[model samples]
Target: MYRYLDSRPAGNSSISLLARAIGKIAQTEGDHTTAIPALTLHRRNAPTKPLHCIYGLGLGVVVQGEKQVMLGDAVIDYGPGQSMVTTIDLPVVTHVARASFHEPFLGLVLTLDSRHVVQMASEMELPQPSRGGVYRPISIEALDGPLVEALARLVGLLDEPALLPRLAPLIQQEITIRLLAGPHGSQLQHLVASGSPSQQIAKAVAWLKQNFTRTLHVDELAARAHMSPSTFRQHFRNITGISPLQFQKQLRLQEARQLMLNQDLDAGNAGGQVGYQSASQFNREYSRLFGTPPQRDVRRMRAN
Candidate 1:
């Protein structure tokens, strides 16, 4: 589905420049965003094992190499000169599909502001989402001229500290405007719509994030989202690619991992903190999700 476009020579140049800029600024492999707010730069020297992380609403530009993001059973792949847009918070297993010491993986990610998107959509008179279509929170497209140039210009600002305060916002606006007018605008339109089903599901997701340590009931979550249980289930799966219960489980497991790694909590304490009443049940579920028992996994993570 992701065919490489041959016609856009300028866009390719922009992508190359983006990769070069990121590689120059990022001395090592990690998020290097100290230079610009909400602008994250990443570099990897080689391919990696699948890693789980929570991806927020943002636009990711793959300046070099390819990556695969797995959400439930769906695998979304993107490569050089490609841009990925995700409209909602998602816990995904991501792998760097292509990279090497010579040509390391380089990427730039921009955190999108929902407020800016909503305001821009209103100003541009974008249409509301149609009622019948299923929603996908993430979409990928080939980079276009305006978006590529805006991103390149934004990264270029790192060298010009004085102009950044004044010009960065303008460039960011241009990038958002390009997205609003592009093929993925409708998806974003629904994401930021206040009372739309997508937003309602987002509200439910927010509640789940806040109350992950507590008991969750489908009916209660549906009521919080202002939808019937069946409708809520349908839209929740459609948008997030997972059930609400699974969503809460991911949050719980991730938090438990953090607690074990950061606070030096034992496996039992970590499990209890994340609402697991039975230690055996917690160990089983944690092994199922992370591919190891909690203590062993924590040991491996700490060693790395």
Candidate 2:
């Protein structure tokens, strides 16, 4: 166990309380999405295998235990008093790295609305970044005291239904502003800036996600983003840490997993629907990525 988990002094009292509140909320809500708007709580009693999904732009603070997210070759590990920020939607592998029945993992996730960020920055006169700056779509940083308190208050609202309607928006706005002023400010600024690489790649990413089943053509996607094939490929990899074809492959596999789990389609049918033509090829790729054949993975998920 980490020493910090056992040592919660006066300085970390709010964080300690926040962990308790998050755990209680997660217990009430189970592992499913709750009725608390964009707020979601997660509690895990044990470590888990790497799970792949699209991580949206959001603020996540681990009040207890730890987690790690893998993007290409980059591995980001965050623990208590630290926060994870994702500026764009990207497919990644993630897992709970540290947790146990005696001290379960507890955390909070809040979605970031770009519209709200723009409105708040305009109202506050926050300075925009220069025209060209490199950006990382995901980052981790220490949570300042005020940010931690704000998140705690936001989660605290879940207990008071009446206060939520009036107070939730204000707290969420505060969080966005704080993030825009923090170390990742330039990244967030470029997110809203017109014609920025981040914004351009975002358009391409959206198109790929919606049309993953179709054959991919880099030139066509580059034309859509107003970039040449080479430039588009470079910027796309910089922002998403994966090439366009790889991104589409992830989307296809994730969709196939859903079809198998929810719709109860056989492996061949599910793979075919996601653009896979050969059953043997689908089985090999599925096993390579998921560590098991599609049927076995789905059955394990159901059993648990």
Candidate 3:
């Protein structure tokens, strides 16, 4: 899509072919985690519905098909030649746009460790920001040969069963280094470094995640991140594009949905487990965020 991705042409090994290979691996092994424990590959057929936000750091590469991930007001798309990189955990609505019986969507997800990202940044002669950089929740760009080749080798290891246990983790680390040197690595560096807003807010985010069920106090969280309440509030909004309360609310609801869908809990009970005092309030918030009530959403997901 973007000028043949630097003369390599993706060759005749089209993304569709890659998708088929990944799909077959999934079929035989049951999940990508089994074949390559270091990376998580989601091989699925395309459809219109969106998936709930998953809070994790990763590089999302599309080997076949297309997808768009929505973060706040921004929508970022990735397909055959592109990928999505998330340096910090944020809520997002993602949808697949292309697929069929003839072609399924193949994608690989690599978990990012912020410490390693910062370490890579420190090793490089990175520029110091003269001013605040661009404000965007997601950034996209073309995938080049280095990224493609690393991914290919990582994927190929699935078939070379005997080599996986020893090799998978190493490749995954290489992929992380590759991304650190790639286009968007600078922003990722800022995210995990001490004193950066991204780092401060991420610290607050981790706290919320670990203590999601507890009642939140803005002042306490701000103190925990070593910032004044006002400064923490402003930075939290800037980095995540959402207020602290809103972030916690999404976390609570998303966790509730997972419980209902995976643990077979009823809607009201799930809400209660996540610090919701009233089921009616939970249903109202769930409907607003998901555009459907909990029971209906879970039922439709199950039928699918």
Candidate 4:
């Protein structure tokens, strides 16, 4: 039996059991929506094809199995007992690297509410950040006792529908509080804090997201964030780990991937729809980023 890292008397369960339940839940209800207000479970068999362009605002916690995600040039890998937090909209390639039918890759995704984070920061007397060193837009770390317990409570609520109505929100708040108190809390704090560089970058991000297909003028984006080009570029790179152009490329490619997956659009049309004018340039870049020519990639992805 695995040890219960959490010291709390109420929230305790074997990891194997929790993993089984989570896997069942994921298999029973596909995708993130099934988790409803608080958490979602994702399970898949071993050697499954990677899921492309998963977009969600949430915390990813692994109960069983392992995963690796690619964000631009950055790659993050996590296994059981670990978690990753996403503070901004990101385009990523997610791999379910380990699983079997009997023991599938099991994980829980807890959606983080910005409002709840802000309120927690206001009430809990957030610890003074010692250093101003930057943090990742997407961060990964080992889970703590408090976080595990909070997650356990959140999962337990899934079985008790009546309690879930009343308790999920409370437990969700508790989980966000725990995250805010954890190692990477400072980033979330800075994200919600007024005048923080991350907040400014978030504004730029919002603009890019809305106007992804539109040609961007850095001058206009800088003006939108109330900062000059030089400062905006520097801080935006710092917060997002990529330059503005790189971020936009990711958004465009992610959108293109969706169009190919959901619609019967051909590669050239999908590229054009995502603002890629030259078919050759689009095909080359698409291959470079997604590791295949558009048609082959889409077909392979669909086969998965």
The candidate that wins on lDDT is: 1
The TM-score-based order of candidates, best leading, equals: 1, 2, 3, 4
Best by TM-score: 1
Where does candidate 2 stray beyond 4 Å?
A: 1-11, 28-32
Lowest lDDT block of 10, candidate 4: 1-10
lDDT of 3 by residue, 147-228 (tens): 7777777787888889988887787778777776777666666675567676778788888888888999999999888889
Shift in Å, residue 270, candidate 1: 2.0
Error of 1 at 37 (Å): 2.9
Worst 10 residues of 1 by lDDT: 1-10
Candidate 1 residue spans exceeding 4 A from truth: 1-10
Q: Write the per-residue lDDT of candidate 4 for residues 1-304, one digit (tens) a residue.
A: 1111221221225555566667656774235455355567777667455655744457987787777776656667777877788887766677887877776778888778777887889888887553475656877777776777677667767778777777788888888888888876886877787777777788788778989999989888998888999999998876666789988988898889889889989988999999999999999988888889988988987785
Runs in model 4 deviating more than 4 A are: 1-14, 27-32, 35-38, 47-56
On the 0 to 100 scale, the lDDT of residue 32 in model 1 is 87
Which lDDT value does model 1 have at 211? 93
Candidate 1: lDDT over CA atoms? 0.85
lDDT score, candidate 4 = 0.75
lDDT by residue (1-304, candidate 1, tens digit) is 2322222223667778777778888879766874668799888888888988888888988888889888877878888888888888898999899988888899989998888988898899777778776567888777887788888899889989999999989999999999988877878888877788988988788788889999989998998888899999998987887899989889999999999999999989999999999999889989999999998999998887
Q: Please give me the total number of clashing residue pairs in predicted model 2.
A: 0
Residue 197 error for model 4, in Å? 1.3
